[model samples]
Target: MTGSGHRALGLAAAALTVTGAVLVGTGVLPPATPPAPPQAVEASHPSRGRTPETGSRSAAPVLPRSEPRRLDVPRIGVHVPLSRLGLNADGTVQVPPVDRPEQAGWYARGYTPGERGAAVILGHVDGDGRRGVFHDLGRLRRGDTVSVTRADGSVATFVVQSVEQVPKSRFPSQRVYGPLDHAGLRLVTCGGGFDRQTGHYRDNVIVYARLA
Candidate 1:
């Protein structure tokens, strides 16, 4: 996908449960850097995390991690390993080639949930008939809960604030990519129903949630 394609794409962190890689070989993405492996922390229920609905780390954390170890959704009782990468210098998300799509995940060197700006998480909808980690991202609703386990053994929780379906032709880049100035989370994935022709959904579904 081109820069235009990326802007039209939705990469809601929560929506990652049903997302995938974009803009390969665009030279627009940044150089890939492996994570130094975040300190491991025990798992905790989203409720047991920092303050609810307004914790200090409630916003998205963009700290470097060994990798995105796990992704948890309280509302849907969904927990899965997160594998993927953020945009490079260009507007592309590095991911496995379509042949080995399931192997794709986040680069793990970008951000963590509940940091500064919006913590973005991405994934594939389906690969080889096997649903991707975020295959069911669209099921998320307002007031739902999403959790990410950081390497420093700290866990941040976020509460769903809103879900929007935007046409790929006009994605809310600044609103989504701009600095949050507060802890936040972005769950991105393809939606508005899948489009077989383009091999992607026509609209990007972004679920905006705040650190709770």
Candidate 2:
């Protein structure tokens, strides 16, 4: 979907549940305060965004034995605790308390970083003038390093491969939030541009990375 279309879809979804502090509004008002999420659900990685298999099957990502607890981005100088949340009925993830509007905590109860599948983390770009944790996420590029401090006190590195700003309308199901050949990381933020009437950012920025 086009960038503008994402705002429409996201706002439409937000409108339904009357989302709490995390209103998912335009850049004008203060960003909504995200809510707490449920525990993590353990599952294997799915091959939704992989190259089509010819006659042979492909291998999947091997998750680390230890789970991740903190995330660090040296390029951006970010060292923050991880938090998680489940998606609302509209498919948008519930927000978490981090710092700025663009930043959010991971749904900790769910998938851990370096797990067999994708570890999803989301934040807002700017809400009502407040900047969230992932506000600068759009700046990430392939090869950029994302380090995670695991619950076991071990650090794992990931290499970024893609940074896409997709419209909320055509959510990148397989592309943005899909599983990896091994443990991976998914970073989400609301960006592109802002709309006054719709009360939502123009596009959704997603950062994809694989364990290093």
Candidate 3:
């Protein structure tokens, strides 16, 4: 999609401060990484005329709106409860409390986990010398599974499509927060070289996944 066609979701300049470092830096988004394999594309895109068996990672049926209760990334050993995150007074997205590094925050104003749009979840990579909920977010590879449990007791399972680490200055806001035809999930956290001067990571690690 053309960049201009997408909504300039306020997340473009969103940032959150952790204990002493910035977790999600301003204007951060996914990297300009190579496109995922064909199978992954099929899964991320709307099913349309294709049948389920056509793609091993075919998108799952969309679910009604509901608050996410938990997030699980079995491969990375992440099983944490989700907290509702909203915009800060200045319009940037809010982050989980610095003391609660084990919890991840879901963008409450965005699409729900099982909805036919990108649902964003944010966490810190590390804070106060402790590992954050998404410390291993960079380890997720294509075809991996990430699931979110909703308040309705249903789980929205997604197959990982790509993992990228990009500098905050080059954050692709359109691709990250833009509208999607199928259910998608985005897990984001700080990564790359840490700038001791600014107390923030130089890059953002973004994991893109599609419902399955």
The worst-scoring run of ten residues by lDDT in candidate 2 lies at 35-44
Task: Tell me the lDDT of candidate 3.
Answer: 0.68
| Tens digit per residue, CA lDDT, model 1, 91-203 | 34555444443343543333456666556665544454444444456667667888877667766777886665555565555455545556667765554545444545555
> Residue-wise lDDT of candidate 3 within 58-124, one digit each (tens)?
4457888888999999998999899988777765677887666677988787889988777889897
TM-score per prediction, in order, is 0.62, 0.67, 0.76
Candidate 1: segments with Cα more than 4 A from true spot: 1-68, 84-91, 96-110
RMSD per model, one decimal: 12.4, 10.5, 8.1
- The better candidate by lDDT, 1 or 3, is 3
Better of 1 and 2 by lDDT: 2
Model 1, TM vs. native:
0.62
Clashing pairs in 3: none
Best first by TM-score, ranked: 3, 2, 1
**Candidate with more favorable, higher TM-score: 1 or 2:** 2
Candidate 2 residue 158 Cα shift, in angstroms, is: 0.4
Model-by-model lDDT, in order?
0.50, 0.56, 0.68
**Candidate 2 versus the native: TM-score?**
0.67
